[model samples]
Target chain A: MLSIPARRTNDVTPSEITPREVFERRRDFLGTAAGFALGTALAPLSAALASEKPLASIKSPLSTPEKPTPLKDVTSYNNFYEFGTDKADPALHAHTLKTRPWTVSIEGLVKQPKTFAIDDIFRLGALEERIYRLRCVEGWSMVIPWLGLPLATLLKSVEPLGSAKYVEFISAADPKTMPGVNRSVIDWPYLEGLRLDEAMHPLTLLALGLYGEVLPKQNGAPLRLVVPWKYGFKSGKSIVKIRLVEKQPQTAWMKANPREYGFYSNVNPEVDHPRWSQASERRIGEFLKRKTLPFNGYADQVAPLYAGMDLKINF
Target chain B: MAWWFALSQGKRHVGLFKIALFAVCLIPLLRLVWGAWNDTLGANPIEFITRSLGSWALNFLLITLCVTPLRKLTGWNWLLQLRRMLGLYVFFYASLHLSTYLWLDKFFDWQEIVKDIFKRPFITIGMSAFAMLLPLALTSTKGMVRRLGGLHWQRLHRLIYVIAICAVVHYWWLVKLDVSLPAIYSVLLCILLGFRLLWPGQGRRNVISGNFKPAQE
Candidate 1:
């Protein structure tokens, strides 16, 4: 019963970011690169493909250095819904989700709980980009470079009550905007939560961006929680509210089918999903023979948290 | 028609014709395997190929099972001649699909595989379907048909109906979104099954039963 969900951080997301802003950023970036290399020795290829530059190389939406590490297969295949809803079409579909003028409504057991706009929250702490592997409960995993500040530092502002047992997250659920949310596959206003102790964990991040750029829409732009220890879905996407709860909250997936998805959704291969096997997962870009690590190779840091409890029962 | 005539005329190269027909049947399988080798089988190629072959197996099995009912409805018995071959081809592709999952996806991980059989809903249904198909394929030969007798053989073959349902369930569970294809397949299966239910024993059996009253035999 290692509850990794609560250990996730709350991020200060951008209030002014938009899809148009991202597109313009790409245009300006390519424009600047194209300008600098106009008269150099290898200028012929650049000149020939100047007009069709964006089409030439599939540019990663996040920023990379001049000689950045070529991305591995895993993190590149993301499923952050704040960015977009497509399993395969994340970066492209995320363009439709508006991330600006965003406000996170904080309520429940917090001492000074209030609805703060994105700017006010982001101004409280510095954002950092850290790469982490995001493994889904559905048995597919990805590695992503995320930019966000830690949850503990941000929690200082909200001032959690001493009785606060769990912190619950609620994602936006406007069916007109989120077409996928309209479907009844899982309950709308996707909910996930973490224990207070887990939420206070230093590794938990509230992500703002990826690849050194403003967070892409498909990668949960604006704001989303990042719990590196738990399965990816436990880190809820497209968040709109943070309620500090005295009791454990009923989450979206658990509400849909309590028998399959437990609230403490630690990535344990031993406990098979009711509909599929968790014994093995396909690491997004890797070969089939690659053995899925226990707790996704983070057992060293987080395994001690669940020492006395029976995982089988909690699962 | 020409090929049928040639066979009726007792042509010397009738075996060659049968071989060519067999090769023609093999073409779709050939193309699919080629696509797989060329790395063009879409995202998650193994799953795609495995599922494709599995669905085709179910389709061909349903088609084979429909032959007798179809012949009864149309007053034509020639369709029965194609049933055995079609049934065996269905088994062949079903085996291929199962083997692909076992070898490629699971890497023959027996413990995990066993866990999947009981734990996963889709895999549970799929494995049951495959298990039923195994007996059907094993008893397909002429010797087994004679040993089992016609009545027992027909009884044993009715297991295919259960297999068909299980196969459909297996397909429906695997889909992440847009269940339109699975819904269509189920409806098609219903119609196929519905034809048999609506028009059972309507051809030569009716004529014989009419003449003999209680003693049609």
Candidate 2:
């Protein structure tokens, strides 16, 4: 059974799942007392700390009587291509990407510019579990249990100056390291940006891990953004730099094809991608009949932020 | 003396040729399994394994179909000797691809599996192509050939044409954007089929088939 966030009861919610949820759920699936025992033994060190941290609270507009899509479906299929790029090739390719010794550089419109190693950044805020529905521009949706600190917490540390209107995320780009980047498909150093207000949203997360584990390379290990309200690509992976700007920042997909991938890529069915329709999305776990949700069911949590604006024009 | 020697030598090479062909067909399957174990099967191993096997199946099928045309155009009848192995390789990879989907993707839930096969247009075509290839594989042996008889064997093998078309459609529909790769495969298929249509037994039949023996004087 689902409890819909009261603001808008009409939107859809992705099935909620996290890696920690998966470890608990695997007991029945693994079908062995010994397996459960082993999981229990492993849970304290691996699962306890992971489950203890609560992420930003997300409100969904839709409610249903059905159980959310199980954790198994959520973690198995993912689209984080920075680990490796291939619609179907990431799971295998991600294993090879190295996530250690990561450093994130902060530049643009900040009162104090700083570069910090991943470990140093993790020390800034306690982890929280934010379960949000992730909608991909490619018409597939998932409810992810992301384990990370809020974007606001990190932003406050940097102290964006009044002039900072937008914040841009730049992913690491070494063609030799990322084969997909070698090809001029969507531009190397995949870029994404958010308005300062959106960047400061509590729901905006700099996720370091998912499913109760260090982020698998396939799922953007080391670090990635998890902007639940916008399309998943806006949550750029393998992030190396955060740039503040006065005007709207030019994102990669927008620069590559301005008409198709807008910077404000909200999950709107009304605005069809010139190449495909956004009217429907395949829920990652639903076999035959997954339906689409407007704003991925976050209208209650963040929609008011855009209350007076024309969604289509802004979109 | 030459005619007698040619007859004896032709009979001698038949068994060895068949062995060579069988070896060629087994290599790809062995390589795939080996790659899987080694973690060299790419980032999304399951998808990589599935798609690779599917592509190889299609490739082998295309090569098998190309046999008659190549034999007719180049007068290299030995090419026909490899067709059985190539056709079998198609079955080998097609079976692996389907099994991976069943075991890995669907997890062998028969009801849902059947539902997906029926519901998804791409899966429908891909499954149909695989289903059509099964009988051809079942009748691959010399014993089965003898059992089916010459005319029946030829008739059953014609299903490859239908399978080829379905395979191309399966690929074309799956691609999201930049249809170039699928388009390239479709063009190659058209050319292969074109060869069959353009030269339907118009060229030499190769009754001698490289076992040339002058008429005994």
Candidate 3:
């Protein structure tokens, strides 16, 4: 018989090998290949397996055809200023956030304003997987598989008044846990807003998790707002309060620079930011900058919201 | 140790010191290469590489500016020998930075590139700063120095001060907030320029430029 090398005592089991579905995810297999340390923490490997409290969600009919951005990029790279402005800051620092004792309140121009526990929010509607195109104001984009109930479903439960023209989303700001809150980068709590109709749009999502697990803290744990038609920042993370109001609310970015950020911060290839061109955005994990689509390729579905208005002025 | 500091007879040390500084300067590029080879360039590899190269380019520019002040203070005339090479490294890193944006980021989307150059103020200023560096880099050769008169060459190289200032402003405007890093670079650039005004010697060597003792610009 030919000499056969035995399986090494330190070798990984077949089950432990990373799934081949995503190319970047194969780094785990290389960690055992000898020479280089890939710098990925072992803790995240189990996290990616999504064995811990995996919530059930059905695939949504509205999902795009694009392959989801790698989970590592979706988790490791974030724009949550509550943690910090740097892309990696949130992933490094968001462990300090306490998502267990969270409660979100719905009030203002609603007949039945109520504060609900985190669990109660989940009971509001059936969860679904919405693969969305997230275009950031800084000329970057990502396709994320979000697990959440629709914002309209949640808004309907609260019962809004006819006079409620806008819905403001207020993110939780804990200075003791969140380090970025200590900096004067912007006003304390991140405030995001949408028109009442936009809030009730079927495309809008009140996301609670992503990649099939309760959301990673960096990607906005507990709960977050997802408006697929707008810039990524318009989707407020770690929302604590939702208030319905008659007048347009001033969001965090608008307060910081009203000239650059407006109330309706929708994605538009024609409208460029003052500092850089938004005509093209480099997608996460991709080398080439792709041309940005009007309303992030959801113009067919959501463009009706801004029917006659000039997008440049609203941008 | 005593043999190392023989300032009057430092010709033997010049070659070795240049080699040492050149290797030291290449460390940033080496790290970037290692990172790219290992697939450890993080979530957005292109952006990370682009920013890393840009930051190093700025750092090299600042380091090139430091050569004259250090030479004047320490009487390390040998330091001047490394100035041209240090300046050329800035162009090297800058060229890499622009290449990353062009090849990897834009993928030769010349339409978007041209529009960005015209529309974006930061890109406009950054492109201008890089443009100013071309003549200085092209004229760095000993042959070119002799071709242009010493006075004319010195005057042309004064554009470095303006280039450095434009670079720092480009950095300052590119950031959405946290002007702290750019603020530090600005202070350093001011001090570098202010030294010329204060001592009034380490500038374009003209008899009328300063009353102080002779020092090359």
lDDT winner: 3
lDDT of candidates 1 onward, in order: 0.67, 0.69, 0.82
lDDT of 2: 0.69
| lDDT sort, best first | 3, 2, 1
Name model 2 segments beyond 4 Å from true. A1-76, A308-310, B1-65, B73-174, B177-217
For residues A1-315, write the lDDT of model 3, one tens digit per residue. Answer: 111122122333442232465335334433342122123222343343246566655556677857677777789889998898889999999999999888999999999999988877776655667889999998888888898888998889989999999999999999998999999888979999999999999899999888777889998888999998899999999999999999999899999989888889899888888887788898876655789999999999888889999988888
Clashes of 3: 1
Best by TM-score: 3
Clashing pairs in 3: B203-B217
Q: Which stretches of candidate 3 lie over 4 Å from their true place?
A: A1-52, B1-12, B204-217
Model 1, residue B120: C-alpha shift (Å): 5.2
Better candidate number, 1 or 2, judged by TM-score: 1
TM-scores of chain A across candidates = 0.73, 0.77, 0.84
Candidate scoring better on TM-score of 2 and 3: 3
Q: Write the residue-wise lDDT of candidate 2 on B1-217 in tens digits.
A: 9854653454347567677668877777777677666645432345566677788888887888887787676565555666777788888878887887776555677987776677667888998999899999999888887787655676688789899999989887765434667788899899988887677553224322433221111
